[model samples]
Target: MLAWAGCLGYAAYYSGLDAVAGISAGAVAGNGVHGAVGWLFSTGDELGRAGVYALTLAALSAGSVLLRRHGVRELPGAVVVLGACWLFLDSHIFWPRGVFTMLAFAVGFGLLTVAASRWSGRLTNP
Candidate 1:
């Protein structure tokens, strides 16, 4: 399917960006930004990865817009909250803590899905 191929292509493009950024910053060959949040923050040159995070936010916001358009009102707000968590609050969601990190994403996604569905139903019904 063209949609699947498009998704894969975009995935490859972003992966390439991460690889280029990570490798050029002396990260290991495969790990994007050294493969963990701890490493991303702990790196000596904070400014070096500034572009990476900026680009990340930019790309993510595009999806956030799609979320908003699809009736998932929480995403734009979540993006704001999570972006703040990543930036000002320094939340541990970005840390590498075994399965806890994965759990965080899973939970966040679960909440998002629930909220989105509820809002989606409301938007459609009303």
Candidate 2:
């Protein structure tokens, strides 16, 4: 959950619109570079933007580490909140390869959930 939140947060902050565009392009034209470049070049104020991005990444990494140690169920609300923020923050932006990123995240999360569920069941059932 924390990892997902971090990824989502990073996606939102870096290239939401470009992500969407990238996804669309990949779906229609089979390419993401155009959309990705769009966002990459859009970063006009590098120093300030980098600072903000760095802070956000730090927070996300810290949150993920803390949450992992504590357990996902112990802070379900926080997980949901972070996930929502990530989704909303990225929804407005488009990027090249954005669709692929979303798909990757979804698949990764799905696999993680399934694996965790199986592990939990094994621990309880055994």
Candidate 3:
């Protein structure tokens, strides 16, 4: 329960950061600074957005360590939240195509569940 809560909390925090970054980028772009909006969303891809990604990674690492102390491996917990975020973003932001998007989200959710389960199992046997 703690693991799930922590992961979800981190996911929400990350999303909030992303939202602020997006708004900042838009404001910058609106001020005639073209090519800057995309940089904020680059995350770890480029040096320009390194600070945001670094902060996010640091938060996740700290959260993972805390979760581990509670007898839960971080991978499954992290995967569950991150995977859901990915599915939500991909379907809504990247491709909002109707039934196909719904199907893709369903499939992705199933896959994420399987992956999280397998990852969680390693904590017991390994």
Best by lDDT: 3
Model 1, residue 18: C-alpha shift (Å)? 11
lDDT of candidate 1 over 55-74, digit per residue (tens)? 34543654465475665555
Query: Please, what is the whole-model Cα lDDT of each candidate in the order they appear?
Result: 0.48, 0.46, 0.50
lDDT of 2 by residue, 1-126 (tens): 545565565556445434444444445444545655544434422322443354345445654664575466424434433453344333322354445445544554454454455546753555
Q: TM-score for every candidate vs. truth?
A: 0.36, 0.31, 0.35
- What shift in Å separates residue 42 of candidate 1 from its native position after superposition? 13
List the lowest-lDDT window of 10 residues for candidate 2.
43-52
**Which is better, 1 or 3, measured by TM-score?**
1
Q: What TM-score number comes out for model 3?
A: 0.35
Best by TM-score: 1
Question: Can you tell me which runs of candidate 3 are displaced by over 4 Å?
Answer: 44-86, 92-126
Clashes of each: 0, 15, 0
Name the better of 2 and 3 by lDDT: 3
Which segments of model 2 are wrong by more than 4 Å? 1-96, 122-126
**Model 2 residue 61 lDDT score:** 62
The local lDDT score (0 to 100) that residue 105 gets in candidate 1 is 47
* Candidate 3 displacement at residue 12 in angstroms: 3.5
